[model samples]
Target: MDGATQFAVSALINILTSLICITLSWWVLQNVRLDLFLRNPGGIQGKMLQVLLSIVLGHGLAVFFIDYLGWSGMIGQLF
Candidate 1:
């Protein structure tokens, strides 16, 4: 493919990965009861923690998915 086509495909892949990561993180946060470990689950600190956890988890999962699909090397090769 040409450079423009390759760039478009790469952009789409990135967007899809981000969407998957957000969905997975949101599902976990909504279904899991975090009160088990947190002192105040609904407090500001707890919410901040939740956001941090979600971002970390999402990034990890996204990386895992990309690696599992053998796209990690492709990304490195592309850029």
Candidate 2:
């Protein structure tokens, strides 16, 4: 494929991966007991915190996965 097509495909994969990871993180976070650390776990601030945490954690995971895939793909160059 051309450079533009490859770039577009990569962008789409990144977006989908990020979104999937974010959703997975949010789902996993639901099991945590936020009340232990927050005075109002049900309040807007608490919800916002949850969202932020999910995004951070998810993005971190996504980065790791992307980097791993890239590195693995380069392994054949060693031959």
Best candidate, lDDT-wise? 2
Give the C-alpha miss distance for residue 35 in model 2, angstroms. 0.3
Checking candidate 2 for backbone clashes, the offending pairs are: none
Over 1-79, each residue of candidate 2 has an lDDT whose tens digit, in order, gives: 9999999999999899999999999999999999999999999999999999999999999999988978997997889
Root-mean-square deviation of every model: 4.5, 0.7
CA-lDDT, candidates in order? 0.83, 0.95
lDDT of 1 at 71: 68
Off by over 4 Å in 2: none
Error of 2 at 18 (Å): 0.5
**TM-score for each prediction?**
0.70, 0.96
Candidate 2 lDDT: 0.95
